[model samples]
Target: MNKVSQILVGGALGLSILTAASAADPKPQDTVDYRKSVYTIIGWNFAPIGAMMKGEVPFDAAAVVRHAQYVEMMSKAAPEGFTKGSGPDAVKDTEAKPEIWTNWDKFEAKMNDFQQEAAKLTEVAKGGNEGAIKAQFGKTAETCKACHKAFRKD
Candidate 1:
């Protein structure tokens, strides 16, 4: 290769390596920020259901179904390991307790149960039966409470 062409190729390779390294080594704060982003989306998706349950807003089955899909997606996401002393920030405003970090297995089981029950509730909502909606919604709420009671701080 000509001298100029060789230099150009070497520069390109160096740039690629730098890019890959940066991508692979995310900072701890960046990881915490990503977790918070996921939590925000999940909270937004759940807000409508909470409002409807409280009778503060009218229920929309289509909205519920869409948000349920989000919930299912989130539930399937692997839990991120928190950086030391980062637990409080990671779970800010979530009913999720620090115990979730301490009792990893139980926390994961509860999360799985939430996913399964939420999926069922989505299916039930699609059936267009008001009575069934009420029943399944109650069940889902209870599931949330069960987890909170065991794992959440007041």
Candidate 2:
């Protein structure tokens, strides 16, 4: 082959190998599983923040501020990670409920609302005002309550 032909063939071969590598990788379901693991980690890490917010634990503004990002992240994350059996057994033992799956539009709306509230809470917390944080925390908590009431198992 001419030099130019060799270069072209090499580029094509590299592209083909890249495509094959990606195709051999895990599918969306596997990706979903990975995201669920991340969600679990975020949940565990945020427990302290939750405790502080509710005053069960001592107030730690820094910790609350740090974990607020995870709340926003998990809230904004796609629901693919929330598949029927994707969570911890304690919280994940049951199906996500037929209503959640069947009425996906409403479920998604609630998720979006929660995400917005979390973002608002993060903003308020970042300002370092306990009063504002408490108020916004209430709003954020209400979002969780609303969604859980509608979609989560008792």
Candidate 3:
């Protein structure tokens, strides 16, 4: 084939590959697992901060900031894991409620709030202000509670 024809054919082939890859959805369980895994990581990272705040553990400012940064990063990622077919009906074992899929807009708004609060916590942690960090961290934790209250199934 001529150069122009070869280039056109190559472009078309690449587009087809990209389209097929995008169209292949993840398994329902995979989606559920992903969201759960993200939450698990967030929890693991958050525990240290909670301990520091409660005085159960020695206050490690650097550790608190690191954990806060991790939570902030993961909060941004958590929403994408709750894809279609990740709901309780599609997965036999999950804590997600049907309302997550049914009332997606509200659920998404809660996720956004979580992300915002997490960001605030990261900012406060960076400032080395224990009081402000504690206050903002409490607010961020409350954001998690709010979402759990609305969406989590026990």
lDDT of each: 0.65, 0.68, 0.85
Best TM-score goes to which candidate?
3
Collision pairs in model 2: none
Please provide TM-scores, in order, for all candidate models, with all chains considered together.
0.64, 0.65, 0.83
Tens digits of per-residue lDDT, candidate 1, 6-118, equal 33554545663333323566555555566557657767877787677666888787877887677657655526534344456543544445776788788778767877877
lDDT comparison, 1 vs 3, better candidate: 3
RMSD of each: 8.5, 9.4, 7.9
Tens digits of lDDT, candidate 3, 27-123: 6776777788899999999988998899899888888889999999999999888888778778799999999889999999999999999999988
Scanning candidate 2 in windows of ten residues, the lowest lDDT window is 16-25
Ordered from best to worst lDDT, the candidate numbers read 3, 2, 1
- State candidate 3's TM-score: 0.83
Ranking by TM-score: 3, 2, 1
Best by lDDT: 3
